[model samples]
Target: MARKVYGISGMHCASCAAIIEKRLTAIEGVRHAEVNFATEKATVELDSRAPSLDSINDRLRPLGYLLLDETHDQGAAESETAHQATPKEREEAKELRKNRNTVRLALPSAILMVALMLYGMLFRPLPHTLYNPLAMILATIILFGPGRTFLRGVASFLRYGAATMDTLVGLGTATAYGYSAAITLFPPVRDFLGAGTHTYFDTTIIVIGFVLSGKYLESRSKTRTGETIEKLIGLQTKSALLVRDGKETLVDVSEVRRGSLLRVKPGAVIPVDGIIAAGDGTIDESAVSGEPVPVDKGPGDSVTGGTINRRGSFTFTAMQVGSKTMLSRIIAMVEEAQGSRAPIQNLADRVAAVFVPVVLVLALLDLLLWLTLGTRFMGFTEALPLALNSFIAILVIACPCALGLATPTAIIVGVGRGAENGILIRNAEALEKLAVADTVVFDKTGTVTTGRPAVTDIVALDTGTAASRILQLAASVERLSEHPLAGAIVEAAERDGTELLECSQFRSEEGLGVSALVEGREVRVRKPTAGESARPEAAALLEEGKTVAVLEREGRAIAILALADTIKENARSAVEALKRQGIQTVMITGDRAETAEHIAREAGIDTVISGVLPAGKAERIANLQQEGRTVAMVGDGINDAPALAVADAGIAMATGTDIAIAAAGVTILKGDVGKVPLAIGLSRATLRVVKRNLFWAFFYNILAIPLAGGAFYPIFGLLLHPALAGTAMAGSSLSVVASSLWLKRMKIG
Candidate 1:
């Protein structure tokens, strides 16, 4: 199945989101649909013959949803977002204004209602004709003023024959106000019905007031979750010094394009990803890679956007601009991850899909049972009052607001916190699964050991050829080959200040290594075969697990050169941390058994799967999965891509190649092996918050719904008031959002 993601608008609650998912999956070509209410986005799965996005969006418009073009937003992101504020920021400001309007009305009305109730208690109550009019004015002000949002929600949501939290709030308050108006203005109706002379103006006023107050608090918490994105967007450089034909002119950063030469001065952020064409600088790339040490970059070295130049100056040709830059992709990936659904959210979606309608049915039953049965025991007047209060309470208390907010709120806060710590989570599901991973498989090179190989030991066997001379000749010949070992040999010769002689007739074998003519002698550098491996010098080097190569001249071995990659400093401690957390650690390598075991032992990994080719790496991961293990593959090389995709969770170092990062579910910046344990720890912490939110929502509904329905009225003589029910319902949603926001206080990777 093919997948597509789109920003969504007009979703007010979980039921509103679930409604869209239902309608989209009902479409002919769409296979599955998931609409996340918190992030206001949809992830859809489609088949080979899926309808166009435009056609599908047309279907959704009638259902009160719009599929926004996120691709357009991303394309214009680096320019428009930097110069102007994002559309989401504008929406947040608008929402805050609306909340303020509700608060201004609700506060005064609440104070006036309390004053009137106190007046009635302290002295003789005003006559029905006078007091009822005062109450009517207050209720009217609260309902249509602060309650307009719910009224609008009712019109937009209920037209499609669906219901949400807004539907229940609007319908319950409307029912109380309308019924009170009829009884107050036309008293004959109440007398003829013989129920009561009292009007429910207080119920109408208090319910909307409490609900609006809860919304005000919720908006504040949500704003805190977006701070990370705001900080990241603010990091983009505003302007650049464009170098055109040897003349430099100041211009906006957005004007930068591919191949445009730009002069970056000391203490200025690089405008975009580019390569230095002239001069050099000390660049502080901590903003992009989270490595604090400034790196010395010279001509031909690449510099990323948003990085600060600490010293010197250089002119670089821009290679990537706008949304193609690194910062923009990170922002996009973070947004996508926050909008994604975890597997645990399936339960919440299934419940929310049918929650409001089920609550409506239960509320109707509550009214009918009280009116028919309770009227006989207590007569018409008293029972009628119980029936009305119970009916309204059931509607207000069982709104499903908290249930809808359970998972997505936690995911948003978790993803935002991860971004601040330089860990990028691609989707919510990865965080969930990685938290419970049983085994973590690490690629030996670049993950646990330093990928940069260095010459460890050089032994001269032929008395005439000195150790320095052997290295100089070998480095000269190997320099012609483009291999990691070749680079190590060249660097060793350069470090020792050895003068390398020129080589002729340079030729290379695939596995046997390079051969050339140096100083009129046939110089051959190759790995030892089975017979040659038995020699004293070769055997000693192989036992130590170094990459052993022989330098041969005139068909006689002159020297044995061994290269070894150093183990990462934190690798052993990282492995120990995983073990302490009840996770098994294994090493996967293409090296010989001796070499693989040496690196594994150094990294505190007891299990070493050696001699596995790149293609076979995925097979090993699949075999581990077949054994019922949740395996997480950690690597920083292109060969790890397939294995990373095949594992239960893929953790890639941002220092690695792009393909590895693209394939992995989680990417850690700074290339520190210690970050592996931190990533898993952060996932576990986030999952705990999600679970706590879900548990509270489910527990609140189960315990509160029956009490609001007056289930214990006969035995305990207890009935909850409609006003208190609305306040509790509002508090439930606020509590769930607050629980998610609490994730910010926890330590992140």
Candidate 2:
């Protein structure tokens, strides 16, 4: 299946998103679809028979929504460069202007509503003058002007048989306004019933008036939710210093390509992902890596775009430019993750799909029941007014906007918060899974221990040669070998400033080490064969958890060199932290039992899965899952990709290979194992906030819907006024937004 993200237009609330989601899911070749109301984007999965965008839009356009390909730049919904006026800014301006214009047009209706409220409080005998031409004129301005969006919702229903939150507002206010207009325009209808000449022009004006005000406030608050994305975009540098033929020229960053040389000045942002060619500096990479410490970079080191050069200046060759840069990928990942829907959001979508229509039916049925039977208990005059009150209140309060905003708003904020902490949550499903994981499995190499091997011990046998002489011979041959252990011996020789002899005819074996003719003598550094046994000194070094390389002349062991992989400083602390959280930590390695056990004990890992090859790592994780444990895998190697994909929640270190990062759901940017626990804590906090938001949304509707429906009216002698119901409905959605915003202030680390 191929997945894609498209900008969607004409979404007003959760219901509008639900309608489009269901419609798109029904399309041929589309496997799944999720429309995020907060992000205003739809993530769709398509099969091999991929449907064209035009076909998808054709189905959606009739329902007043369209899908725009982000690449075409037509009707583009969001932009990455923050300093420019982009499509996102224009759309926001348009929405805010639309509301302000409506608020102005509804001013007279608002004033009239206040006058009616004061007069109705003082009088008992309702008159025909209450439904006069002046009131009808004001209500007409509201229904056509400020209520235009609501009318559009009604038109959508009439044209496509789709109902949304707007449908509720449109139907309720339109019913009240049409009835009141008929009573004022023609006296025959009022006299035909012989009931009363009462009109609900006041209900029509006040309900829409209050709703428009609440919508205006809600739009302002919603804009603040995208601040994190905007800040990330603002980090991009607009230009770079181009270096060519020993001359410096300032050019746009877009002009810099692969192999192009760009110079970074002190305090300037790195132009793109590149390798340092000259000079060195202290780089403040906190924005990209979430590590508080500034990193020192010299020649041959890699620098990332958007990181600031703090002290010195350097020039580098651009390896990754434009969208391929780390910062750009991060922004894109954050956006997609924010747009992706959580599994819990399905519950909201299902409810919103049927909520509007059910409320419409309930509103109509209650109105009919009140008009027919309520006249016996109270006179016709009181029954007609009470029925109108119940009708509008029921429709206005059960809008379901709160239900739609519950999950997406929190997910957006949560994903953004994770990005700020150097943790990239790929999607909402992983975020949820990580919050509940019970066991964390770590790949031993390059994860718990630094992958770089170093010389730890060296001892000479009874060969009458000094240990330093053995080191010189081994380093001389190992310098010609490409093995990592060979590099460690060479580096140790260099550090000791030992004299080296020129070697000839170097022959290196894969499983064994290398051999060379140095000064007409046969010198070899090789592993022990099946028949060969290590000396007592070598066996003691092996027991100390170090790999021993045997140095021999004439196929006999003369000296022993031992090397060990350095354990990360924070590995032990990271394990202890997980254990403190009641989580089990296991180390999986390809080393023999002795080395793996010793490393596990040193790193505080409770269990060790030793002697497993790279292919068996994923199986071990699956086995852990079969034992009823939620497994989270952490690794930083190409071999860890399969295990990362198979684990419940895969966290990849930034220092790892790209394939491993791609296979994982979460990424720690700085390659710090300590961040593993911090990421889990943040995920847990985010999930808790989602639960709280969901509860509040469900609770508000359960309590408010019945009150508006007059379930308690008969006994409590209480009825929810239409205006108050509208206010409460708006408050419900705003409260959810506020709850999501609270996540921004949490300090996860």
TM-score of every model? 0.86, 0.86
lDDT of each: 0.84, 0.84
Q: Write the per-residue lDDT of candidate 2 for residues 1-749, one digit (tens) a residue.
A: 99888877677778898899899999989999878888788889999886899988889887888886655232111212224554445566777888877877675677667777777678753455744676788889888888888888899899889998888898889988988888778889877656466677777888888788778777777777777778788788778899999999998676777999988889898878999999999999888888889989999999998889999988999998877889888988898888887887888888888888888898888888788888888867778878888898988988788888888888888889888878998999999899899999999888998888888887877569887888899999988999978999998899999988899999988887789999998899999654444567777778867888889998778888889987788999999888887899999999888888888988999999999999999999999999999999999899999999999999999899999999999999878898898888888888888889889888988888778867788899888988888889889889988988998997563
TM-score (C-alpha) between model 2 and the true structure: 0.86
Instruction: Please estimate how well model 1 matches the true structure, expressed as its whole-model Cα lDDT.
Output: 0.84
* lDDT value, residue 314 of candidate 2: 89
Per-residue CA lDDT of model 1 for 166-255, tens digit only, reads 778887888888888888888898787685657778788888888777777777766676667777777787788999877999987777
Per-residue error (Å), model 1, residue 566: 2.3
